[model samples]
Target: MSELIELFKDPYERRARLVPALLVALPLLVPLVCVYGPRNPILTAVLGLLGGCGALYALASVARGRGKKLEEALVKEWGGMPTTIALRHRDSTALDSVSKRRYHEAFSSKLGIGMPTAEEEAADPARADDVYIGATKRLRELTRGGRNLLLKENIAYGFHRNMLAMKPLGVVACVLGLAYGLIIAKALQLAPLTFAPGKIAAPGLAAALTLLISLAFFVAWVFYFDKDSVRRVGFVYAERLFECLPSLQPTMPRKRTTKSTASSDGPD
Candidate 1:
């Protein structure tokens, strides 16, 4: 399972999609060929083509799952917080001069909003350059360990976004599978079968069954994995976030230390 997951990490790789496509396509194709290919090569070819397409879609699903996992991991590793500070003066005309002065001061002292002066123009330019110097303590309270908390939040957000994308795709795949099954069933009824004497009644039935089963599996997978995975990722991310911000930590109730008065009884 670990190896399989590792293989999925590079979603851009064609193998990820190809493997799943084969898995689904082979099973469906086998049943269809056995049932329908004795006399009509054309029908068999058509079924194979359809099965192949379905297989490709199955592979895409696997790739999507892998991509989500990889995205989350990357976000977590980065510690997801703003590493640089952008500062802008109140007047637009004074912005460039103010920015240059601040940049020079920060570079000379290695203090205040830590961002490379050269890269400032190239980076997220839309980001406001307002520096709330007094908010350092509060910012620390909001995001502890600076980057670490931000990284977790970013990862959590990624998981949530991926889950949202998967939910819709799962629904669409299931619906398409149903429609495909109906179309195949109608096609089978129109075509005559030429199986060996006393053999199974229909060949196309197997393909339909395979598709339906795969569809069902995918739907179940989405429901079982997507939301729960996102929730788990979010929970861990939240814990990490809180750990960074000391103020977010829960205050334990203080235990009262009662001093007992010992009455000394003389000659007791």
Candidate 2:
């Protein structure tokens, strides 16, 4: 049961759970409260309890989708790689360790790149350009020929590239979400759709409407923006795979400068 709960912990899953309940309740609640409001408190509470079930259903569906997306991404990245890949197994251990030092140590050792010191390990994930640049440079120095392949294929390097792009995008996403939420809140205050007549009391109704509208816009924004962002991040990841590893350096095509030919008559 605990494991099952942990499975749906992702943000996508949580939002999925919340959105559906709001959608269902948003329509039903206004009617429900109007019909059997302050007069029948017990019945209203019971119905509210039952309505919460929709949230659970939403959570399961969203989590399944997230899991599927992750699996598809992994399948695409893994391609035809063999089952005995050391990095595959090493990743599990690196994730389980609590300490940043331990995680980086395990990851670097697995990739045959020397581990960074404690201070270096403590660098912020959002801005690890200096750390990765230095570590990647050292990784190149230590490699002879094919050893660089290890760094090229390291899952951490891939995630780092993906998340590096995601960091700023995430901030922008949050700002957009907050703005959407605020707009909804303001709209609710201006509109009078409350249970009571002149008093305008229905907190529940206001919350539901705001959530429904704000979430819809947020989902639309993510669909439009994040799809392209994912592609660009993947490109950066592939670029990093080539740049970080010296073994693949020679394979990269060098740009040639075009030379201009002057007229012999003009020179004379």
Cα lDDT computed for each candidate against the true fold: 0.41, 0.37
Clashing pairs in 1: 21-55, 35-203, 79-151, 80-150, 80-151, 86-129, 87-129, 88-129, 144-244
Candidate of highest lDDT: 1
| Tens-digit per-residue lDDT, 7-82, candidate 2 | 3563333332333333323333443464456788997878756545453554445433443344345435643111
Name the lDDT value of residue 138 in candidate 2: 39
- In model 2, which range of ten residues has the least summed lDDT? 259-268
In the predicted model 2, the residue pairs found to clash are none
Tens digits of per-residue lDDT for model 1 on 10-92? 33233323343343344344445655677789997786575455544455566456545544554355322111122232323
Q: Give Cα distance to truth, residue 39, candidate 1, Å.
A: 11
After superposing candidate 2, which stretches have Cα over 4 Å from the reference?
Answer: 1-43, 51-268
lDDT of 1 at 38: 78
Residue 89 of model 2, lDDT score: 21
Q: Candidate 2's C-alpha lDDT?
A: 0.37
